[model samples]
Structure formats: C-alpha cells, structure tokens
Target: MSGLIGKKIGMTSIYSAEGTVAKQIPCTLIQAGPCVVTQVKTTKNDGYEAIQVGFDDKKEKNTPKPLQGHFNKANTTPKRKLVEFQFNKDVELGQEITVGDVFEEGDFVDVVGTSKGKGFQGVVKRHGFHGVGGATHGQHNRQRHPGSIGAASYPARVFKGLKMAGRTGNKRVKIQNLRIVKIYPEQNLILVSGSVPGAKNSYVIIEK
Candidate 1:
C-alpha cells in the first residue's frame, strides 16, 4: 500500500451539516506532503521496486555530510525525513508526489504512531481489576490492593501472564478506518475524523 508522511497538529471539533448532534471527532491536522521522489528502484538495478521520497526542508548547516550526499544526488535541498514505499517500477527520480496524489475526502485510512506514555500505574487503572472490598469490613488501606494471589497449597506461585500494575502506553499503535474529513491540496493538509496516536508534532504514517 502507498502512504504519506505527516506531522500531527493537535485536534479540534467541527460541526456537521445535519441538525442531529454527533460526537465531534478529535483529529490530528497533518501537513501531509509535497514529497519529492529522490530515487526509484527497479528489479534490474536494485533487485526490487520502490520509490524513495523526501519531505520537510532542513537547514543546510544542520544537515550532516552523509545525508547531504543523498540530497545532492537528487539535486534537491536536504529534507528532515526520508522514507521508501513500494510502487510501480516506472516511477521516475525527481518526481513530486503531493498529498493530493494519494488521498481524497471520504477515503478510509490507517494511521500508525506511538501512543502517549503514562508511566507506572496501578492494577485498578492499568488492568481494570476490581480492588479490595469495603472499609467497613476492617479493610484498611488495602482498598486498592490485589486482594489474593491463589490457594495456599494448590498454586503457591502467581500465574504467568497475569495482569498486573506496571508501565503503560508509549508504544506503536494503529487506528484503522479513520474517515478523511477534508483535504486541502493548496496547504497540503489532511483533516481526519478522529483522534490519532502520539503527541502533537509527532510523525505519523497515513496508509490506505
């Protein structure tokens, strides 16, 4: 599948045309593309087919020597991000593939990103386990404790793969079938229908 690289731009709510109330979707506004095809690979030349693309400009002084060589080969300025996607063998080098080329309004897309980190958490909040019973029954500060483990004799050790409190979030996640609310080709922006993973300004891959 072909996709585009974009930066998340927070979220906001918008109203629909019908009078019926609907949950305003929180979306990540993305500055999608103006991506330049830096290199095109073919089975005869590289043993496979793919197109290497570059996006977002970077200061010449900030770019390193190794990457500078890459940009020079394409006869373009240094870009902050570079990615490759499989495509037809006929794609040409230096060709520009904008956001408008890949997606359109009402299209279904899958967004891939890293979710927000939540640090260490308790079982009640992490695993959704029921805590201890009432305080009236002599249950002290053990209200949020993991009441019991198992039988004293039959299973002395805790079971493996048991849900427990620990670290959470900050992992790769994919939200599938998100509606493409709008597409602004002039500004290179894509308005998705709901919240996506990752923090603001984070990179996300939008795939069809």
Candidate 2:
C-alpha cells in the first residue's frame, strides 16, 4: 500500500450532494501535493522495495547542503519534507506524484500523525480508573487518588507497569479505515470524513 505525506490544513463542515442539511463532520483538510520522487529503492539494491517522496518547496537558503545534493540527484528543487513509503515496485526518480495520482473520493485510507500533547494527568483522566467513593462521607481530596498500592507482605513493592500519572499525548497515532469524503485535485487538497490525529497544521501520512 502506497501513501502520501501532507500537512493538515484544519477542518470544516460541508453539505452532502443531495442538498441535505449540513453535516458537522470532523474532517481533515490536507494539502496533498506536488511531490517528487527523490529515490527509488529495489529489493536487490537496498534489501527492500520503496520510494522516497519529497514534498513542499523550500528556498535554497533554507535547505541544507546535504539535502540539496540529494534533491539535485533527483533533478528537483529542495523540499521541506521527505518521507519514504514501501511500495510493490520502484517508482521513477523525479516523477511527480500528486493527490490525483494516489487517491480518489470514497477510497479507504489510514491517517498517521502525532496526537496533540496533554500534560501530566492523574489515573482517573489517564487510565479511566474509578477514583475513591465520595467527598461527603469522610473522603476529601483523596477522591482522585489511587486507593491502594499493593498487597502487604508478599510482593511488598509496588508492581511495575502500574498505571500512574505521567506525560500524555504528543505521540504517533493512526486512525484507520477513514472514508475519503472529497478530493480537490486542482487545489491539491483532500477532505477526509473524520478526525485525524495531530493539532492543526501538523504533518500527516495518508496510507491506502
């Protein structure tokens, strides 16, 4: 399955074609690009089959020398983002792969992205643990605390992997089998039917 690298352009609600009422869907607006094939890897040469695709134009002053050389080999200008995806066969170097080339409306795809960051949180919000009973009946601020640590004598130490408060979110996540609502090839944009992981303007990878 091949995929495209794109930037999330926020979300919006749009009406269906049947003139139905506006549906408030969690749509992801992505700029699905004029990407250039930077490198082609073959099974014999690289022990795998894949194509390295580059997206978004960058000025020469903003691009590093090493990457400039890389894009030079592809006979394309410097790109801001580059991602490699494994494909069944090698793609031609410098070939432009646009949104129209990869996907169409109603296609099923999985969107991969980094979820928004949430700071340190308690077990109730983090692990969904039922906190202590009540505030009126003797229990006070302890309502949010984890009740017990462990058994008394045997295995006295608190067990490892016990759910605890810590940093949350800001991790790579994938939402699978999302239906494609629309594709705007002229704008190089794709509208997905549901929410995708990550904050607005974050980069996402859409895979078929």
> Pick by lDDT: which candidate is best?
2
Global lDDT of model 2: 0.87
Q: Predicted candidate 1: what Cα RMSD to the true structure?
A: 2.7
Question: Residues 1-208, candidate 1, lDDT per residue (tens digit)?
Answer: 2888888888877766656666566666887888888877778999988888888889999999988887888888988888888774455677778889899899999998899999999888888877986787677788788777666876688898877888999999999999999899999999998889999988888888
Query: Cα lDDT for residue 153, model 1?
Result: 75
- Candidate 2 global TM-score: 0.89
- Each model's number of backbone clashes? 0, 0
TM-score of each: 0.84, 0.89
Compute the lDDT for candidate 1: 0.84
Off by over 4 Å in 2: 17-24, 88-90
User: Listing every candidate in turn, what is its Cα RMSD in Å to the true structure after a full C-alpha superposition?
Assistant: 2.7, 2.3
Which residue pairs in model 2 clash with each other? none
**Best of the candidates, TM-score:** 2
Where is model 1 more than 4 Å wrong at Cα?
19-25, 44-47, 149-156
